[model samples]
Target: MAKMKLRVGVIGVGAIADEKHLPNWQELEAEGRVELIGVCDIVSERAHEMAAKYGARVVHTDYKKMLADDKYDIIDVCTQNRHHAPITIASLKAGAHVIVEKPMAMNSAECRAMIQAAETNKRKLMVAQFMRFEPDSEKLKEVIDAGRLGTIYSANATYLRRRGIPGWGKFHIAKESLGGPLIDIGVHVLDLAIWLMGCPKPIAASGKVYRMFGDREDLCNAEWGEPYDRKEFDVEDYASAYVRFERDITLTMEVSWAANIENERSGVSILGDKAGISTSPLGLYGYENRSLTTTRFDWLPPQSGHRMEIRHFTECVERNRPVRVKPEESLRVQQIIDAIYESSRTNAEVPIKAT
Candidate 1:
């Protein structure tokens, strides 16, 4: 007479888990749609604390133990970039759908492996690309799908923080997080931009990275988080890339955790032959009646993209329908990231092999 509740487990009870993933999943638990079964983290105290706070039935320091201990219907992974692939693959093989944090994994190879595991397991896998769930993004996508912005050719994604390197986590450590803002905040805007542009196949990328202020000793880093050792900061704070896609489509991206700028600026702009659109002000620009005109939204629903993203994943899992953020699409984004890093290393354009 009643529906069964989906059991959910969460890995990596860190800041992102606490702030975004856990709170939203807990809300779903309250709605009787899902049960928070287990919370896992390397730090046992954090695991126990989140388990108690979120009404999870169990706590685990090791994710393997968590997978062995219970059969979860869904596993939300909020781990570091390097652990995304392994944890997600393991969770999928263990008979649970997975939703991992953005940037997917450390490299394209890992992304492909994760996708394969999901395919083999017949489970859903989704990336938490929260920006795509925003109201403005949804509206813009509708306009684009309707051919309002005809023949989309190029786009630009920019995310720059004046002096905002993470002072807290393993973000500055290259071995732990892969790279700096490119893989960090850069991935967010880049993924959103490409998704809005209809996800063209990226052919090649040319890029460069710079470790400007992150590794320095004399900079003010008090605003971000707790202070960390300067010697541990080895990743690039800034990255720039130009990516070429199929059908001559192109995208240029610039991201920095620290830079010399008037203020922090972040937005994605899509250019088309007929018209153009920008995300910051949610506006469209083009010529109307032989005169330039701009249409700006005076109001849009202010919904939390993270909450919407979590709900979307849960609904897709429940209905056994396709997820909004498909693994193949995320793999493409990972491919672009890999090419950019390789291009930076060789100081030449790197081709993105088809996967």
Candidate 2:
């Protein structure tokens, strides 16, 4: 009959599982669907060098002993942000089907206990929000799901990196990346500006965070990697927020790794009464014949939003179908990053409670 394959497994072989989920799960294990078996890492030589560079027959430094030794259908967590809810709730109670990485945990009560351990183990819980698998965010989410961006509201998420303070790993260590650049790269442009405004339900947030230049010591990061310890730089190189969603939808965020910005900038811009979009030069702003138009994107297909977000979560777990990054929309982007870090620790305005 020739069907069954999907056995994959991986749990933090670092640097985003060596640059984006083990080279796209070794290209879906050379297209015979899947079967990387295992690879974990508390650096047992980076879990045997990423399980001998991704062929992955097995190697773990205890992800609860690789979930009590094998039996995965799929579990690629790329860990950090505090072991994404206890290794995705112990790999969904050891039955697998998880895809963490993102600001999906370390808040929102661990994203509601990793979505209640993937809904009491029915499994499938994705959240690698790779900017919604960007090709200019899937052409502005197909022109805002074809209503042409009408009635959306507002957005503006920016990611700045003028001094790029990521001197490799544990990103300035707020107990291992819980905050900084608003949960790293501000949870990727605030989860791509709240999934391009169609996921609205954030309720509230107002923020502030800054540490100037990564706890300085004559700072000059010299190209981001290996030079960390300025007393282990306690997080927050910059962050700013203002979110509110559900019907009246609004968002405004700014992230940074170190600022005084002028060099690296990131995008996300939405605002629709009828049209408005922007994701770094892939634009559209409207008023068609009443005359204030602007649309761009001369050509698009250059895909690799982390290899189409690990090939759309391995084709929605091989066609059981339904995971375009939803874990209740990453627990509403981790409840607006736990209400912008409890509104930057009680400066006020925090509300957000809508899992």
Candidate 3:
């Protein structure tokens, strides 16, 4: 029997759709993997534009109406973080599987709601934590599994940019979108830590957010600051967190947009008793008897992210299997995020309660 093609509908034809998801799906369609069914955006012009460009037959401003009228098997939510839960729950209840853009939802409560909706509908719900599909990260996980990183102790990560802040549709620094680099770029790095630690349950967490990157709406100047305003800075441009995993593994996360750091190092390095490894540079640093040594070797591309993640989703939808980036797994990440937010608010450590 021949494989079935998933009829895919994309919500939000903005930067993420145009630059990543749609392109990958286009390639997949060219390879006979899936069919482009519909594209919807709150902005009808954007929907029409992507529809015309991607050969989608239907375009609509209201995603609910699109779901009602189209025969799409999968609904991909690429909207802002706050929109993730609503769209995903709607999609699942509409009898379609969903692929939500990362950060899952605005908070852990929303994440749990989405997870429950998926379960109730028996639909596949996935958080687009694309880093888990990266090859280098996959290899590093393997190294940890093989005990190369014996008795994993600590994990530290940094995701910093000189001044690159998002400027599209409340994505830059909207408090509703959860603000700052932490939920934006930092979510990926934090997810990397959680994934590398085998998605350990976080016990407690503490965090702080900074607003030094100016405002979040129009006024701030940079490549992506046209839609930003220095006066409306409601979210943190910098965020740091310390998470305690179940096995006593503590992960430290730092992310920033307008920091004093030189260059970007968006990676997580795990310090184990035997060795420490990191990606984005793929370095292994450890003790050799009396002397400490750091080794960097040329390895095969470890970060095949966007395309692979899209393909995996398509595969799961076609096979009727649950999504690889399980919704429950993402709930845990949201727990940490909620803890960070609560910690920042109360100026104290917050206990992480898993959903």
Model 3, backbone clash pairs (residues 3+ apart or across chains), number: 7
Best by lDDT: 1
User: Candidate 2: where is the Cα deviation over 4 Å?
Assistant: 11-36, 43-57, 60-127, 130-143, 150-154, 158-169, 173-179, 182-187, 194-209, 212-230, 240-252, 255-269, 275-311, 316-355
Error of 3 at 15 (Å): 0.3
Q: What is the C-alpha lDDT of each candidate?
A: 0.92, 0.83, 0.82
Mind giving the per-residue lDDT tens digits that candidate 3 earns over 152-211?
Answer: 878987898877776656765565688778888888988887788677788899999888
For model 2, where is the 10-residue window of minimal lDDT? Answer: 219-228
What TM-score does structure 2 among the candidates reach? 0.34
Give the CA lDDT, 0 to 100, for residue 15 in model 2: 85
Candidate structures ordered by lDDT, highest first: 1, 2, 3
Clashing pairs in 2: none
- Reference-based TM-score of each model: 0.98, 0.34, 0.93
Q: Per-candidate RMSD vs. true structure?
A: 0.9, 17.5, 2.2
Relative to the true structure, candidate 3 reaches a TM of: 0.93
Prediction 3 global C-alpha lDDT: 0.82
> Which of candidates 1 and 3 is the stronger one according to lDDT?
1
Error of 2 at 128 (Å): 2.3
Residue-by-residue lDDT tens digits, candidate 1, 1-355: 7778999999999999999999999999889999999999999898988998888899999999899989999999998888999999999999999999987999888988999999999999999999999999998998888898899999999999988888767888988899999999989999999999888889999999999887777877647854878999999999999999999999999999989888899999999988999998689998988999898888889899999999999999999989999899999888888888989999999998755
